[model samples]
Target: MDLIDFSAIATEHATRLKAIDPLLPPPGELPDDQGVLTAEASGSAALGVLSCEKTPADAPGAQWRALVEHRLDLRLAGPDPGTALGLLLEKWQERLAESGTERGDWETAAVVIRPSRDSTGSGELLRHGFAPVRVVAVRPAERHGRGPRRTPGVAVRTATRKDVGNVVELLLELQHYDAQFGVATVRESTERALTAEVEEVLAKDEPLLWIAEVYGKALGVARVQLPPASDWSKIYVDQSGRPKLGYLTSLNVAEQARGTGVGTALAEHAHQVFDTEGVDLALLHHALANPRSTPFWYAQGYRPLWTYWYRRPAVR
Candidate 1:
């Protein structure tokens, strides 16, 4: 494909996406929207486009402290999707090598793939050392009834400043559980940082912090952010044109509280809050490798919208 043709294709892709959802954020103009690289084939043609952007070291909650992020969008038009993907991967590796001072110097690389209907490039991604790290799961905001019925002893209520310490502890416990799946590490600073975050949330009236208690002792915590008029709110709306959006940022239950219906109660309560606030959709992300979270969220009716594939080369 020539430069002009490639640019038109990229623009068309973005336009189609926006048309699907007018609120969708614009896919920023790529630096190399004009074809920087092309693939030769045995019988057909393929095109590969790569875009790089610098990611700040202190970007909040980033998985890695990478200096740059490379995004690869591969389009193949041939009978052999596998071969075309292989060619794209080869070109991607060459670009990475040329851009970095040495192999594995870059902190992180990623690609976004839709795996709902097809598995076209999944194998190629795995073969090239990418692992699925985060899955964006979403569900319509229809009421799932008030709260967990089975757990009669558990009570859910809005958290207060006095509950900050307990909430922080529950969050740390969650981090420890997440660490088992290699999603996060519980550092010494984690507690202090989390404490501050909880305190701040408690101070805010918009994003709610809820606690699940049994006999007046906190055993679970859930944080839900009401949609603000900004980018984060628009990202998770249901295609059915939800008037409002709600994000279930974090839900953590104490180890002993698992399987006892505490999590269900907490989640249902959050949903009730969303329903009361006129939210028509809810969104959350969980590590694909988290065995407990994976099933629990699916049971709650959340399905994956996008899967984030991550690659971090081992540094010296």
Candidate 2:
């Protein structure tokens, strides 16, 4: 609020941004046009920092970083005697001050920051002092065509529960290539997640675990993850105090199904369904390291939403 606080706020924002930048969105041309930007970073640093006695989270790394994805909205207000682009430098010092006070608190962090461009309200406050609070989800723009997928008959549908096993196997296959995109969710035979993952998928009315039939046999599997309702709920609130959309989470298709339109079909179909269900936004995360996933989503009309970053304070 004062001259002293911008550094603190900016520090927090930058710290939060850097910490979460790796896991959230790919940083490209900042989304100044649509009022959004995205960056990515590993959640590992955030994981170590957020490990505290309070703010009890069970699956600490996954759950806590996910919170950053949807719930990272922070704002700092201070004096803004606007010039050209340099107004931001003053804001950083103030923000840094504020964050310094809370250094030992709860492993606190933020990422995938969203900012608003309220240009209609013309004034110094609107122009000078008005730095946006960080928000979580900034989705891609309207997309009719995205990644390529298997053609219609190329993808066969699963007929029965017996098909689920083969589908799960194919899913495991894709996970090997997932590391190309910075995901390290490799299944351990020592720590078998197959049974648990399968059960969770089957329980969903919108089961992400799907079998793609080829040559009269199930050769591939793909799945979609619906982000928790809360992920969208925080962003979907209206002036009238009502929530609008539910969010989309992770989606994966088997290697065999890759160029045949399986991923593209699933994504397009999901988009149509979301539109029909009155959900206005569809969001997802992909690896920056993977050239295909990022370009693939970009082709689908998803624009840069926000950027996240990650690094340990010790490392910095």
Candidate 3:
């Protein structure tokens, strides 16, 4: 299919998606000259778009590495869309090999899909070996009223140089919890890297690191950062035209303190800080399969905005 055809199909997909999630952003129009693969059948079509980008490695605290990201947009008017999807994937893999991606330079392959309840695309993705990894959730900061009352005896305060050791410990605990979802792995050097990250955040003015403590013993930690001006200004804003995006990067409480009010106190504290900074929207990602996170975040008033599906084929 040509750009004209691709644009028409993409527009239709966007319309259907907006009916489901009104907050969904408009899809970008493809350039006629850009290379995009297309699979066609009688009365049906699928578009495959490929791009390679650098991202943080899978190992906890590892540096950035290259990866291939594929996006499949399907609009099937026929009886079977799965066949079109399968053909798209086959051609996508072939293109990757041709682009030197199969030489083991890329760490992984990722995809993004917005599948509704009756979306056939969901089953097709799983059948092709993709697994859901991260869920991007959003909540109107305006709705984030004063969170639960702060638990007595638990204090939330900014991290200091003296808290680096304790902060690293809490971060490692969080990483272990994340590993249960299979997207992350703990490494021997994680502590060292986490310590450096904590120090950096403490030194920065835009990103605030908060720690929850009881009697001077750290029990939980939360990291909140001001998003880039481009994203904050363009995508999320208030009536006054002020940027209103704050991202909660990581929040975790020690296993021993799970049931206690420590986690709630820490999260509420973060929200208080964001409110004070004039933020009107907050964003975060958690593993869809993480029982602890899935429930806790929803209870905190966040709703799913996007889902990232992942697949790692054996190095050829």
Candidate 1 structure quality by residue, lDDT tens digits, 1-316: 3323655545554555455544344444445546455554544334566666565443434332245556665544444555656666677777777665356654555453433323556787778887787677776765242223446688888898889889988988887777665346455556767777788888966548888998888999998888583237564443445467788889998998787789988888887887898877777878788888888888887777566676655211
Q: Flag clash pairs in model 1.
A: none
Number of colliding residue pairs in each model: 0, 50, 0
- How would you encode candidate 3's per-residue C-alpha lDDT over 224-274 as one tens digit per residue? 876463153233222244546778878998898785778788878777877
What is the C-alpha local distance difference test score of each model?
0.66, 0.40, 0.66
Model 2, TM vs. native: 0.53
Question: What does candidate 2's lDDT look like per residue over 1-316, in tens digits?
Answer: 2223334434444444445333232122222222321211221111001111223233322322321121223322223222212233223324433545243222333222332231211232233333222123434324455566457675535224566566556546655655333323352330245545566557755564455555555655544434454253343223132323445444555665566676665566556656665554555555444555666676766654443332111111
| Runs in model 1 lying further than 4 Å from the true structure | 1-4, 7-31, 34-59, 62-70, 73-82, 101-118, 143-149, 205-207, 229-233, 236-243, 314-316
- Clash count for candidate 1 is 0
Off by over 4 Å in 3: 1-4, 31-34, 56-83, 97-106, 113-120, 144-152, 187-189, 205-207, 227-243, 314-316
Q: Please give the lDDT score for candidate 1.
A: 0.66
